[model samples]
Target: MSAGAPPVVTEIARPWWDALARGEVAVQSCSSCAGWVFYPRPFCPSCGGRDLAWRTVDPAATLYTWTVAEAPVSPHFAHLHRPVLAVAELGIGVRVPTTLVHADPDDVRIGMALTPVFDAGTYPGFTLLRYRPA
Candidate 1:
């Protein structure tokens, strides 16, 4: 993985990627326990139920935690000179790993309200989900 690398779109995760491409967010929800699932999977991790469905969710989130990269942490991220990597917690309690965009790193804080930034064309065929202060 490197700069301009093609984003991975697996068959099982196609719905999530497609939704992002359309400027929306979609997550897998457990049909049995009503629990939410991120990082799409075939079965529900909560109830071990085989039935799962893609559900659209509000892209809004709260900043759970964040860090400003002084240098690339790994070769895979060598292109990002100084990215604000963050974990955002959605209202439904699912935490998404993303980059905080369009804000000063000094201003980023825990529990800050965040809005979705549908980053289209950055990865060629993919639209990455980023966040910014709301």
Candidate 2:
């Protein structure tokens, strides 16, 4: 995401990221199609609706799928303090993704219910959304 000539946000999304400092997570919900959209775009993907708004989610989800990080790409990743889990799935029928934390490899599996967790430690230069086995 850093190969761009410049960052996508300057004045558009600083408020969204800054909201994490106060403890909240949101996704753009299209008032037209009633679909949830991520990456916080200004329009809806399914219906191409211009009427979109930020909606707070329950921070609870499920481990639809995941993988283990056995290889390291950067020092930042090496010292992550523990192995990582990436999960995705049909929440409200929208495929939401977030890192999985606080669960053992054996304890986690696809279809397991998970919940959103704010990992200040996993803050990737900004606050990040993570999940734990719900």
Candidate 3:
């Protein structure tokens, strides 16, 4: 099998992805309710507001949880050696699911400070957002 495929950039998420390409991590914020949103949606989940805007936020986050992948579930992941997958809660209260890189699985702990790692070389035309100890 081939390496993992890149994410498809949709119209709704283009700004967020574009920001990532520029080495800036951004999330959607509701203009009406001032709520933070992830996964890129047309409306705000907090107040069901249609007025939403992309906002740059601090890349710092707290590792909420994580798991280690010892074996490749697919050929795309064969290159990864015991990759650590983590869910981190950003400073803005958004929980982002991302890979934890440049870290030992054994050393990772809950509540550890993490910062964003944008892998622009991994996938052409797209940047893979990972995290590392801060």
Candidate 4:
């Protein structure tokens, strides 16, 4: 993949991507069940409700797990050396697969506080939501 390779933005996920472009983060939530959702979909996972809404969420999160990529997983990531890939549990209990920016792999710890960092340039057509030590 090239650096310009973009995510396949479906109609359901457009709002979330748009929010990321505006320096905000949001998740899908069921209007009926009040259940939070990620990787946007048309129906609620908890109640199978169709009344879902996009809601802005706090950028705060905690590192759940991470790994250092000394070798690129794909050609798109070949430009980066030793990038840290991480999963962070958001305040509302969603686990996000994100890159850890401005951090040393050696210093990262499970349960470390994190804050969001949106990158609109590196990926060309899409904005990437990443995290860094808070």
Candidate 5:
């Protein structure tokens, strides 16, 4: 495989890759309410506090919901459609909508458990977190 150009990583998420490079989950945790947040942010979602800090969360999460995309929404994704799909609800309380890999589309269901599988994309050369049935 040929190496390709890297994708443009946003400034807000660059720290996430730095943490992943160390094999650690750099999720934001609330200092006021102690609620763990997935998408790294500067404030607490539960308490609206600005004293949030990076903390490690269990890579484990339950599948709260899911959806099968069935249709090609993007030109780049059209060729990858072997029953291409999207899954939702990751982590304990965090909800993330993303692509599902290594699983059959017919096998997807709501409220199924899932875990994280990290990948450094071939063309984009960036970290991707894929969910798996747990």
Candidate 6:
């Protein structure tokens, strides 16, 4: 869960954080195996390839699953009474853990189309991704 802010950026995940700051989402791809990688790493998990490339992907996904939290999962989220936590599957088959926004929690459905909402100022110097019904 790295971010643009200090103490959140890691050497292997800097590109991802930087891309999010620019309102984009970037994923790593293996040059040797042509496999997609998420959660940023130094080597390809598919084929142990050291040659990894960062590619910006379409900020669109489908709801893979979700839940409405009865209480804040963390103190940082205390302001939100009930948070719609969700895992959205991107077109490339990567599932991202994000918050479902701008919709009613009861209305969320599996396989529902979603789009990214980048919250640049929620955390100082960090950009976060959320999903909303598309």
Indicate which candidate wins on lDDT. Answer: 4
Assess each prediction's global lDDT (C-alpha) against the native: 0.89, 0.66, 0.88, 0.90, 0.63, 0.86
Q: What is the lDDT of residue 50 in candidate 6?
A: 95
* Candidate 1 lDDT, 67-128, residue by residue in tens: 99998887778877689999999988999999988879989899999999998857778889
40-60: candidate 5 lDDT, tens digit per residue: 676777778888777665665
Model 3: per-residue Cα lDDT over 21-132, one tens digit each: 9998899999998989898999998899999888998888999999999898678899888989899899888998899988999899999999889888777788878899
TM-score for predicted model 6 compared with the true structure: 0.91
Model 5 clash pairs? none
The TM-score values for the models, in the order shown, are 0.92, 0.75, 0.93, 0.93, 0.76, 0.91
Question: Looking at model 3, which ten-residue stretch has the lowest summed lDDT?
Answer: 1-10
Lowest summed lDDT across 10 adjacent residues in model 4 is found at 1-10
lDDT of 2 by residue, 8-57 (tens): 45554665566554567666788998988776777788999989887666
Per-residue error for 81 in candidate 1, Å, reads 3.1
lDDT of 2: 0.66
CA RMSD, predictions in order: 2.0, 4.6, 1.8, 1.8, 3.1, 3.3
Looking at model 2, residue 121 earns an lDDT score of 52
Candidate 3 TM-score to native: 0.93
Model 3 spans with C-alpha error above 4 angstroms? none
With candidate 2 superimposed using the best TM-score fit, by how many Å does residue 119's alpha carbon deviate from the native?
Answer: 1.6
- A best-first ranking of the candidates according to their lDDT comes to 4, 1, 3, 6, 2, 5
Q: If both were scored by TM-score, which would come out higher, candidate 1 or candidate 5? A: 1
User: Which of the predicted structures, 1 or 4, would earn the higher TM-score when compared with the native?
Assistant: 4
Off by over 4 Å in 1: none
- Candidate 5 accuracy as lDDT: 0.63
